[model samples]
Target: MAVSRGCLCCVKYLMFVFNLIFWLGGCGLFGVGVWLSFTQSQFSSLPLSFPSLSAANLLLVAGGVTMVTGFLGCLGALKEQRCLLMTFFVILLLLFLTEVTLILILSIYHKELDEKAKDDLIKGMKDYNKNTDLKNSWDNMQKIFKCCGVSNHTDWHNSTGTGQLPSSCCRPGTDPCHRWEEPCYEKAKNFLLSNITSVLVFGVCLGIVQILALAFSMLMYCQILRAEKYMD
Candidate 1:
């Protein structure tokens, strides 16, 4: 009984520490998701759904689930409650499955999604001048990405019905002929792709953590049951 108690204590603290780290990671993910959502809101006119916005939404969901799971795990470990421990395990299992499905779908439809996003962005460009929010967003994106229109500078000509490119399309004090030749869509796509990759990696890591958490929770739950039986 003494050895069992010691072992249980060790496992309890281990679960607590693990969950604390998990919760912190979830907070970071949530913060990044919120930032992305705010920045991408300017492009809301593009489409109801786009890669960056979708990714932000994904992050928010994943983060919220992770935080909830982490909290359950932490409280269950400290209180040694079988119900909370089981709930944590169930939640983690569901979250893991959901992540796997999303990743698979994203991998399969990546090209199609990219094309859709490009089409949407190009379509939105037509209203660039007419929509203050979109215009500012485009200008901000161009400046940040150091790129011009969707496909290239010429795209603006069609969208604006004017040959003049926005000043954001070129470096300050540079000749108009020297406007950025890279497409804003490509740059933005690449940026979002890199972030998605990071998210994928993070998801895998979190899945592993969840598996460990499940193991720990079950182990402690069984130990608690055994201790109660011993007392009886």
Candidate 2:
């Protein structure tokens, strides 16, 4: 069947919009990842825990990949280049598969992952004062999360050998308050775990978008091939 000119025009416009959104999202991710990487590098001298550092590095990689793929997709869609479209489709498909696999693995080993994260947080807390960046990071987390230590306030004592807690552990507007009884670990952990669903949802949604883009690209490529044949 012959593809209508109107249908082709619509597909072209739709793809342009989709690719534009994808490109913007990629840029945002890349910018945030770069920021995190720079922040992490500043604390290289500290005994930063692997989980935190690894997370930052992962962000950088993800951002870079997203940006490159987004550019390819935009270019392919705009120029109607079959080779670029195919390349975009392949990369998007691979990313989709990888994301699904990662989700499955994470679901299967959530408990172990949680425990590992706990250990890393404790280690980071123990070496917090060793580096300025580490100290600032810990303080900011405590302040923002309204948390104290990995497991409890006492964890700070066990980890730092210091009887006094950082002021950030105190509740806001009560700077002089001496209530070290509050534990931050549970709060921080809960906060993080609560957001996991949203992240997963976003990833799944993005994967679906990629699938649509792949299908559109492939269809358009075929249409282009047919058009060229008709011309010849």
Candidate 1 clashes between residue pairs 3 or more apart in a chain or in different chains: none
Displacement of residue 100 (Cα, Å) in model 2 is 2.0
The estimated TM-scores of all candidates read 0.80, 0.70
Tell me, by lDDT, which candidate is best: 1
Cα error, candidate 1, residue 197 (Å): 6.0
List lDDT for all candidates, in order.
0.81, 0.68
Q: Poorest 10 consecutive residues of model 1 by lDDT?
A: 42-51
Q: Write the per-residue lDDT of candidate 1 for residues 1-232, one digit (tens) a residue.
A: 9999998999899888888878877886787789879878766555645667777887888788788889888999999988898888788788878878877887899888778877877788788778888788788888788898877788888777887888888887887456887888788778887766776677667777777787888889889999999999
- Give the top-scoring candidate (TM-score): 1
Candidate 2 has an lDDT of 0.68
Report the C-alpha lDDT of model 2 over 126-205, residue by residue, as the tens digit.
Answer: 77777677788777666666667766787778888998878877877885755445455566445445644554565566
For residue 96, model 1's alpha carbon misses the true position, in angstroms, by 1.4
- lDDT score for candidate 1 against the true structure: 0.81
